[model samples]
Target: MNFPTHIVAVAGLIINDDKKILLVKNPISGWEFPGGQVENGENLIEALKREIEEESGAIANIDSLVGVYSNVQSYMGWDGVSYTPTKVILDFIGRYVGGDLHTSDESIEVGWFEKENVLQIIENENLKDRARDMLEFHGKVIYRVYETKPVYSVKSERYI
Candidate 1:
């Protein structure tokens, strides 16, 4: 028997005491929240925290799950040799607990931005959707399905 696998990833929308949102400037994804693919045996929350620290040098106190997004399209890897798996991203809302802002290999720039300005900062349409949901979270978790190849377009979205 064979089992199907999906690339599961986690991210945190971190807000500091001043109500500024944390963002990382990734070489590949541009200005987006800190997060990455879950490593083997790592729980979602743990992976989110690890990604936040690894990408932005900030410790976060995760508060709640904000949304779950499914990219139902498969795309070529950076090397252009093989197709990548479909991705399901779990996004969480959190508070910046401690640690000064710093950059890492995954993030060339890390800083806090006003919540209202996040959509303007993020270049990717899909990431903007995630950021928008995180900004407007009102005690509901959202589930969205989208495709990215031809253009970023939503297939479906609903509150969960």
Candidate 2:
């Protein structure tokens, strides 16, 4: 019997004092919330803070968990390779602590965007949906699951 492996990740919808949402422009994922895979031994909140700081050079105070989003699809690996996997993303609503916006190796651009502008700039449907949900969230945690096709062809030999 084959069991599917799920990659756990975390994302932060950081809102600044100006009511703008923090966004990062990743080369592969495009404009989206700042986040990455949860490191071993780190809790989801810790992972979210670390990822936000690493990717956007900003400090985040986690306000609450917005939702859990699951997407079964092909995604670019950290090594620049492509792979199909089930990505489980925990989304959090965070408040900006401090630090100027700057991009790291993982992000091409980092900046704050208005809610309406965020919806326009983020082209990925999943990301756009997540942002909208975060904005409309009313103290309740939500769960969403998405089904997607592999963008690359898989060979039986590769798996075996």
Candidate 3:
């Protein structure tokens, strides 16, 4: 049996001195954590740092891995063809080190939001959940797999 290719991505839950979370508004995902697909030769931590810098212009130090989430859905690929792909995102808790706040080409806006406002500001439910999970993270890594589209269902979950 042939299996579909999966895209591995990394996200940073950067908390600043003001106790706010950094967020980026993307055309596709709305207000979410700053991150992107891992490039060739880049490990998860390297990709996370690069993505956070590229998307939010912020420097961060990854403290720990918060969780791993899998979202399987159909979307338009770079080739302009529709494909069902699994997006596996590794979320990490990061401490904001320094750098000016700026948005990249992939982001419409970049700003810090209070933890209480994340759910209301972020349009994606899954992303909101991820944020909440990261905020409440207690040194344990979470693993979650979801089947999206006709119905959003959790396939599996565990704490590691």
Q: Give the best candidate by TM-score.
A: 1
* TM-score of every model versus the real structure: 0.97, 0.84, 0.90
Q: Rate the local accuracy (lDDT) of all candidates.
A: 0.93, 0.83, 0.88
Kindly list the per-residue Cα lDDT of model 3 for residues 1-160, writing each as its tens digit.
9876889999989999999999999977789999889998899999999999999999999988999998977666657777757799999999999999998898999999998888799877778778878989998899998866666678889998
**lDDT for residue 15 in candidate 3, whole number 0-100:** 93
Residue 53 shift from truth in candidate 3, angstroms: 0.8
- Winner on TM-score (1 vs 3): 1
Q: What residue pairs are clashing in model 2? A: none
Residue ranges of candidate 2 with Cα displaced over 4 Å: 1-4, 73-82, 150-160
Q: Write the per-residue lDDT of candidate 2 for residues 7-32, one digit (tens) a residue.
A: 89999899999999999999888999
What ranking emerges by lDDT with the best candidate at the front?
1, 3, 2
**Which of the predicted structures, 1 or 2, would earn the higher TM-score when compared with the native?**
1
Q: Alpha-carbon error at 34 in model 1, in Å?
A: 0.4
